[model samples]
Target: MNGSMTDTKPDTKPHSPVLIGLAVMLVAFNLRPAITSVGPLLTGIVAETGLSATGAAALTTLPVLCLGLGGALGPAAIRRLGVDAGILAGIAAVLVGLLLRGFGGLPALFAGAAVAGLGIGLAGVLLPALVKRDFSRQAGRATGLYTMALCVGAGAGTGLTVPFEHALGQGWAAALALWSLPALVAVFAWAPFAKARPAAAASVARRPAPSLWREPLAWQVAGFMGLQSSLAYIQFGWLPAVLQGRGLDALDAGYLAAVAAIAQAPGALLLPTAAARARDQRGWIVGGLAAMVAAFLTLAFGPEILTVPAAIVLGFASGGCFGLGLTVIVLRARDAAGAGALSAMAQGFGYALASLGPFGFGLAHQATGGWGLPALLFSAIAVAGAICGLGAGRAQQVGQAARGP
Candidate 1:
């Protein structure tokens, strides 16, 4: 549990922290668009492809499942590619997957989603480690910035894809494909760091950290991560469709989703910093979960006039929840290696658990022929997430004394 394996040596002429932060944000920007873009366009994809409800659910679920699988690969990627190269590789995969999804037929679309999910999984898991490694002094703030960028990206993907589709005159595929451009930019921005050697590489090689798989706190963190993520991905994959079913036009629903997503930016930016400064994050976690549940209820049954406000509230609350969830990972770990390991466990198991939310929502809607069941389901998830957060929000480091055999 010592910090030797995670400490970086002071660089004689170090890269500016601001520049590194910018690079991290840029990479983070590419993470959500691949999945978010699909939600706003789901109706069209289902219509054009003649997909059944189940098939469409699978379309959204596949990438999220891949995210978990990819997260499981993060430690291996760090060992083989180093953090920088690992990120570069992840972005490249995203770019390719976006392109493939945009241009191909049904089979190609699913294939592309899997590829992109893998990339997202890999990059998502590694980014926290990079933040822990380079920004240990300001991990909370740094997590906020990147998490904000991620929210912005999610907003853009939801907001802009519709506009892009209309402008391109081709369809949803073209709009989805356009997301690859950001991935291309991220790859270039991150390439310089790919070759830079991490100072702790030697230390990491000499000492293996304890396994976190059996740690109760690690499981608590992972549960918090997965359950919150279940809500988040449900929003990403279904909120717009839910709005459309409420009689809004596709464009309006998409914009509302964008508003919710963009609203998260400020919350993502501010909450983690506040939580990090607090004695414990439990209050923040409970408040965020409460807000999210309220927003979900409002969106599900509130008046039409209240829709925008609900979206904004949902976005802000969800952003806070997500940013704090990630902040806990860093706060709970003793070092960068531990952060990487905890992140992988949380995201790997967490996202896999998350994929069920959207799929289950689709199934619930299909089974009941109403949003009531789905609304109840959302409430159940938020309540469960809160329980896990209460445990994870404690001031303690994981894997220090509770390592798995």
Candidate 2:
């Protein structure tokens, strides 16, 4: 593991950096729409499908669980398919999943979500490695761009689906299906790179790396990633429902969710650069988590007029936490191989842990017949994330101290 952590290799083929960056962003753009699109439409889904709160939660949780499954499988998948081809495969799965989701039934919806989650898992794991491999000199900046695209994509899905539904008069299913078009675009954009088979493919395949399960720093990072992600996914899966419960209409709730997602762009674009320049990331992580907790509480329980403001704050704070989360994965690694290993460990274990948030939230709401218990759950997650961030934010590369003398 230590040996793999330090190995560095150069790419044989010189591609245009601008083009590669564009392709990376385009791929990132497709990662979130499928998931975000569902939240705003959840009410209608439950109405038509006759699903209880628990069942609805399961509908949302399935994809996230698959994300973990996909992430855990990412290393082996990359080894076999190589990075470019792996990402291409992931996007193709997403395209199929999106189309499947539009087929109008619970079976199709769950199946599509599961398949898309797997693709998201695979692509999400590889992207950091790609940035670390190709943009080694400016990884922080590249990460920001990647994260920004994710926010924009999420915002588009959250904000646009209802409008699309109303405009086309094709119901929620068709609105959900429209996101597939972007996935299709991503497929073509990423295909050329897969064909080229960049050196990153060979480099990762040649390396024999150990698991990060035993590393303390790795666990801290994963803990923080999981906890924060739980909060983020809860927002993606339930915020609109929560808002609608507060007396807002579906369109208003959807717009609020979109506002939160779009607002993430600035924080996502800026926090990584700032964190990279700082002495240590602990302060940033701690501060972001604190802000996140406050914003969430405000958004959920505060006066109705303050809802938008709270969401904006929540978005910035959450984006900062997320941006810092991905940044630390890169910063705490010695090389691209280490980044990939840490990413898989953090995201795989992390997302698996995160899958519980929405499930628990639903159960809490169902059990209590109110949002109070779920609000408490969200607060607890934020506090736990801050605690983990304290350890993860320390300036130490994972596995360095774990290596034998």
Candidate 3:
């Protein structure tokens, strides 16, 4: 493993662990809503904006694309600004994006999503490193907590957007804009913790992160991140729409999506903690992929009675897979700088690759005019994720791949 970070002083200072932990949870909570909320509201947005199905897909695709692009900038920002400042900036961007989205118009909607996605990307990479740095002794548990927060946030976004729209007398823009409240709260909530960590910025700046782009294991991890993320984003962007095509109305479709999303919370809370204590995470990875495949298959051809249960299974597996991906980033790194680099590398390339999932689903649907084709494609994605996740889930670190016999 890279040893360059050893010289930096440890951060055991002004901020209590509770404050930092709360900040992490709040920030994690902000990452998904700005993006996930759009999916449930897509039908309304498309109707009002007159966007084609593919163009509407861009509402989801653009942010995900920005997520990859923005993640690439995280390490550099942290290198210059420190973790706290970097995160603060990220939260600010999210707030700004939400405001832009809420303001109205299609251009504003896309632009806002892009901006928020950039913020999410920056925040995403930093959170893992923060956990690795501050809660090293309980990285798994801490990660699980924050991961659960992420799920809850995503679940709320999926489940609540329709209701929010209804409550606002079917005001889609109003609903989309209101999600800013939580992100605004996150910014204030993160401030005290950021203020307490002035020294951490200096320490992190002193460490030179190694180049991970050349490492094969790093690519494996990136592949795992990308593949699983593709599935998750698909769920985020298209699951409701897919279900709606089956005969459900907007609210019923939203509820089904919510059930799937909320189901993820348990696995997000438990799997990473369990995986961290294990000798290897391969079994969890495989199990999660298996569940995704099953979910897809059921959605594709099973009886309607099985669909809801399958969605629950898919959510549970997805949460475990995603949580494990976050855990591996920390577990495979030797220090915060290393974790930051790995997180950037994984999320950067990974999300860039994943951004295509939603758009592709849209294209497949547009082409075949049904969910059958896309469901098969989703199964294919699950198989690919399993292969990559199996490698990423191994009991090894990224830098160690170079030194191995």
Prediction 1 TM-score vs. true: 0.95
The residue pairs in collision within model 1 are none
Which scores better on lDDT, 2 or 3?
2
- Regions more than 4 Å wrong, model 2: 1-13, 402-405
In Å, residue 329's CA in model 2 sits off its true spot by 0.8
In order, what lDDT does every prediction score?
0.87, 0.85, 0.84
lDDT digits (tens) for residues 307-387 of candidate 2: 989999888877778888888888888777788888888899999999999999989999998899999999999889989
Predicted model with the maximum lDDT = 1
Name the 10 consecutive residues with the lowest summed lDDT in model 3: 1-10
Residue pair clashes in candidate 3: none
Cα lDDT tens digits, model 1, 52-153, are 999988888999999999999988887777777888899899999999988757888899999999999999998888777777778889999999999999
Residue-wise lDDT of candidate 3 within 1-405, one digit each (tens)? 011123234664455567667778888888888878888888888888899987977778999999998899988888788888888989899999999987789988989999999999998988888777777778788888899888888889999988988898747888988899999999999987677676776577568887998988788888988888899999999988888887878888888888888888888889999999998788988888888878867755678998889888878888878898899888888888888899999999999988988889889988999988888788888888889877788888877877862
Q: Counting only residues 3 or more apart in sequence or on different chains, how many pairs clash (N, Cα, C under 3 Å) in candidate 1?
A: 0
